[model samples]
Target: MAFNNARIDAVPTLCASCEGRKKGICSALDCEQLVELAKASRKSTAESGATLLGETEGIDRYANILSGVVKLTKTLPDGRQQIVGLQFALDFLGRPYCSESPLNAEAATEVVLCSFTREAFERMMQESPALERRLYRQALDELDEARDWMVTLGRKTATEKIASLLLLFARHAEPPEKTGRHFARFELPLSRADMADFLGLTIETVSRQLTRLRNEKIITIENNRLVIVSDLRRLKARAGNS
Candidate 1:
């Protein structure tokens, strides 16, 4: 688990002030464990489009997302790329105990990461069953989500696919607040091209479906990336979810 790359030492006070401390993988640690983890960790940020790890690259560390989004992508031999998954706030990054990344991880939005040296993180996980268990649970949940998305891509219609994508973003976004009559607002982290890549649809089709939803008064797009859901139930119905 040792990485030859330069390691950055984290400030203990920085870990104490992290917003994701309660929700991230570090949440499994006790106070003493947190101090130890903090000593081995560093805080870093990635701007949109920055690659955190390239496909098949050596992994030096693992990280917890404190804010923003990251996209995991795989490219075919011919250079076609597909976004395999998206990670949001409090999600763990890097394959624990593994030396290489199977896919590329890139920042989809400005991102904050709390990173730990691979050797340090693996040692901590080995000594802490709770931490290991929490990571295992997260892996299972991500596997389930991947399977569900497989169904969405293979079986759903264009409209259903678009609705499903919107629902996915809505669930991860800030809790819905009543703005006007029956409306709730959230910002979309993915661009239209990113959405299309994830959904296996053409950009035109994605745009068309979004337009259809807007015309139906189901959702409203503002400032390009902001979305306002007019009715949660209606949007879910269009997603083909009961």
Candidate 2:
């Protein structure tokens, strides 16, 4: 996709409220520091399924999700691929001290990101102990999530795998109360091929399993998006969770 060259300030966002809201890293930062960091950030957009950075790419900048989701994927020599991480709004990007990226950071959907040069961002982090501490916590949390996904992909049944993924989407999504039952409605950010890579299944299997879920009244699919009519507890049971 051709990228638009809009200025950073021209990008739309509510700086102060965003810094104080749920699912936002800014909420954890002091106002003065947040203001300082904001001044250094630049905004960019990526279309759905765009590769923002590849494994072979040198790390030049650090980024944070201003909106939409990103997928961190690794490919094996034999062509096998796995999505190791999913980054949502207010999530960090680029390993702090790394010179080269180990995986591809792709936009799972049309996304807006706030970026900073790697060297400057790292130096700033060093000068700001509170920011550095928060980043450390973020890394640990991401590692824990990676481990959890590994377990799901390795041991879960196809149905359970899909259910777990759906539940996670629900957990990260905006308020359900505002949209009524339609709150469960949202597009799958990644394609079935990407889903297969993440779930350790073939694309055909993923498609079939999704159909089976709908056939069993577990979910409904329309235009490739899913709607979960059942409560989360039921979905978790389908996920084989105790």
Candidate 3:
């Protein structure tokens, strides 16, 4: 707690190096405010397959994803789960003022999060209009992404859908290590089954489409998980995206 009793121009130590502070809504706050909020914050990690929030789970805290991917899933009464969306690094993890989570949020990869009490977060939102507006903008961005996904589901062919899914991960997924090349490289975070569920395709169809992409040289698969998007322009073209 070096910054505890003594005040300086710096943010709290815990938040000084947080990705959320640089890229998320926390960027809207100044040093003093970050210090105040940091008092209520804690950093934690979850392995892949860990559930961060469940449907009907009471809202106790809000978090900013520090790293890795989180999938938001909606379950039907018949016991089917659909991956509705994904949260990447620096994405905010809770809905302000919501009493409970309506969907289940689970880690799609090993994840790091910086979480703070709901009251503290809400209080800060009230005090910092910038932070509040930032969150609102993020919500709107998610809505826009969802609308785009609707087009993919309703109009795209199976190959286009597979390409779209791969491009989706390419846009958000950060590989465990950097390859430092001209083209985009990422590890497919979801399994074939989960990807099938996300894209409304059968497991066999997903696999077949992936094989097609590999044969076309648009992408290279190392093992079953690591994917290197060799030609992003071609990949984007295949996905029917700009």
Candidate 4:
């Protein structure tokens, strides 16, 4: 998919996420300290599908997204992949102190990242208790999200998976106005292939399920971009407790 580089470059100024700011994870720091840390950050961009780091690869740096999306995927020797997590704007990647990564991180869409050398970042964290605390919180939050995904993948049916995923988008999604209970729209962050991998289903199965949802009047898709779901409660019912 094509992305506008000019638009992406314009995004950081508009970013509301902490990582986009000078203090970043050190949001609790004094102005002087934040100013020092911000000076060390460098910006870089990656195209969709670019492999940032593969599983088992060494990580010399850690980064925070400035724009777009990234996916962290784990694969088996038999050629199956399961998307473990997604890194959106303001999200950090490449844990410090880890020599090798367990998952491969790739650009799910064109992306920009603000990078810092791992050693330098670790040093800063060591000196900054507030930063360390924030990182710990971030780790715990990710763990919770992982457990949630596991529940969906292991117990939810195809219809349920779609519902749960859409509900997730709704939680983070920003619409111009609260649409009536019947309908809402948002762009999908990942392609059908990535969605299939994340949900532990075949691409064909994903396509069929999407079609079935539309047939049931649950959702509508247009231009490979927007998804409009009518009756979110029905979607939730389809998701059930799983």
Winning model by lDDT? 3
Clashing pairs in 1: none
**lDDT-better candidate, 1 vs 3:** 3
In angstroms, the error of model 2 at 208 is 1.7
Worst 10 residues of 4 by lDDT: 5-14
lDDT of each: 0.87, 0.75, 0.90, 0.76
For this target, which candidate reaches the highest TM-score against the unseen true structure?
Answer: 3
Best to worst by lDDT, what's the order? 3, 1, 4, 2
lDDT of 1 by residue, 51-141 (tens): 9999999999899998898999999999999899999989999998678999999999999998988988899999999999999999999
Q: Model 4 compared with the native: what TM-score?
A: 0.81
Which model, 2 or 4, shows the larger lDDT? 4
Model 3 over residues 68-160: C-alpha lDDT tens digits?
999999999999889999889999998789999988999999999999999999999999999888999999999999999999999999999
Which 10 consecutive residues of model 2 have the lowest summed lDDT?
Answer: 5-14
- Model 1 lowest lDDT segment of ten: 2-11
> How well does candidate 2 score on lDDT at residue 183?
43
Off by over 4 Å in 4: 1-19, 22-26, 78-80, 177-184, 230-234
For candidate 2, report its TM-score.
0.84
RMSD of 4: 7.8
